[model samples]
Target: MTFLWRISETNADGLIGTYSRSNGLDRFELRRGKRIEVNEAMPTVRFDGRTRDLLAFDCLSNTAAPLVSQRMAQALRDSCAQDVQLVPARIEAADGVLDGWSLLNATATVRAINHRKSVYTMVPGTQAIMSFRHLEYLEGCLGEHQLARDAEYLGHLLVSDSLAQALSDFAGASFERPEEAYYETMSRRWNSANDAR
Candidate 1:
């Protein structure tokens, strides 16, 4: 009963930290579990002009780095200390430096995709997956994890049911039901077919 984040552009109300100035930090490095070196432990970043204020747990625009409030970070530490890395980070708004926040880097990845049971498409000619028509996890693949990433589905950060329940009350959190899948390509194909009509 694991869960994954389902961020939406329509939900955010204000801009969020872009980490634009942080040289070593990026989405790829964090998600890939790469060790990043920063001159200062707490790198400063300002809210970008896009949309969304800091939430208890949130990812930046285009779904970049995962950021969490102190409260949420504590919950993550208590639950999945080995599965994650919470790097010290600072967020700035018009007022000043935001305290009690951290960058979440998921360190544990597993081969959790039950490919035989999951419905997905490969990128036209590439080996990469393009979209999922449905998604399912492999039996017994999660082990004893509070948080994790599926090596077969790199786009998401999955949380064990216990951890998901613990953070259920956090405002602006976006834990999705495990049954959901990212199927953007399916939508586009439908739209293009309609356009031809």
Candidate 2:
């Protein structure tokens, strides 16, 4: 299925939530403890027959390109500190906006909708702030497998000063100290996924 990387925000109570997606009405809720954590990973998709149809949207698809939505693209913009043009690398777009984009990675899921999405760019200037994997899909779109790969990739990206700055800009707050609480959540998800594997 199609997937993207994302960063999400939660209310104080951490119940009601929103994600980045093309669909305007897709608001998601997190369980008791399912907030996005720093240096963590989560799945983007599951390979169930019910969702096999979603594979049609995979960026690697040889048929008609998938249709990414404007709503989701807007979410990516909101997640960033400022909008900059993404470079062409693993990313493929003629001149369209970040609105209708999806990733070709194998770890995407089509479960809950995701919001606040953006195409990952390895540009020198932007990379100094945020080190994104292939792309950023926010909210709730991935399943389990995709989450792990994303976390692994994101953790590596965080090692850079620029990535830190980019995350700060996207979150609109300073993340000076590492997120201890987020680490715990990430550890659990990783261990669980590893054990299952």
Candidate 3:
């Protein structure tokens, strides 16, 4: 299966934003004040042996560096507020050099909106702003052992040196902001991928 990851960046008052994509539709939201921005994407894919939906989120907030870090940790805890236990896990970047980041693993039966079992990871980034990436793969995609393997793979990709370099270039560029650059990059990548098809 093909995994197409969409990217977005936002800069606004209160520093809250959301980006959601499902079934070829995309929605974005932003709010003001001390709030947590939840960016969710539900992409369906065939993994393991069955078709499944993967729910992903990138939660970010803007504040003093210290507060941002604090909020990031708190947000991670809040994500698994239900009957779920989070275990500290190691995620190595493919190209090495994973600075100021940590990953947490958990498996839970989410019963609030839908009754489904899921395996998820909470990745907190302690950069200029506090940011957290939450990724959940439905039960079928990951069994007991697969969870660790998949999580590690994802972690490595997230912290890869190549990814870091690209992001750094995006940040240093005078393209208004990283979010705009990210959108453009994703759009270009998507267009190229579709063109080849």
Highest lDDT: which candidate?
1
By summed lDDT, which 10 consecutive residues of candidate 3 come out lowest? Answer: 46-55
lDDT of 1 at 59: 45
lDDT of 2 by residue, 93-121 (tens): 22222223332112222333121343233
Model 3 agreement with the true structure over 28-101: per-residue lDDT tens digits: 11111112223332222111211111012222222111111223334434532331122211112222321222
In model 2, what lDDT does residue 95 have? 28
**Where's the lowest-lDDT run of ten residues in candidate 2?**
25-34
Error of model 1, residue 185, in angstroms? 9.6
Off by over 4 Å in 1: 8-11, 34-41, 48-63, 181-197
Descending-TM-score candidate ranking: 1, 3, 2
Q: Write the per-residue lDDT of candidate 1 for residues 1-197, one digit (tens) a residue.
A: 76776554444546644565455555576676434554565655677442224543344333456667777788888887888788777777665566666777787787787788778789898888787777777766778877777776676788777887887766546677555544554577789999999
Question: What is the C-alpha local distance difference test score of each model?
Answer: 0.67, 0.27, 0.25
Q: Which should have the higher lDDT, number 1 or number 2?
A: 1
Query: Best candidate, TM-score-wise?
Result: 1
Span of 10 residues, lowest total lDDT, candidate 1: 48-57
Provide the TM-score for each candidate, comma-separated.
0.77, 0.20, 0.20
> How many clashing pairs does model 2 include?
31
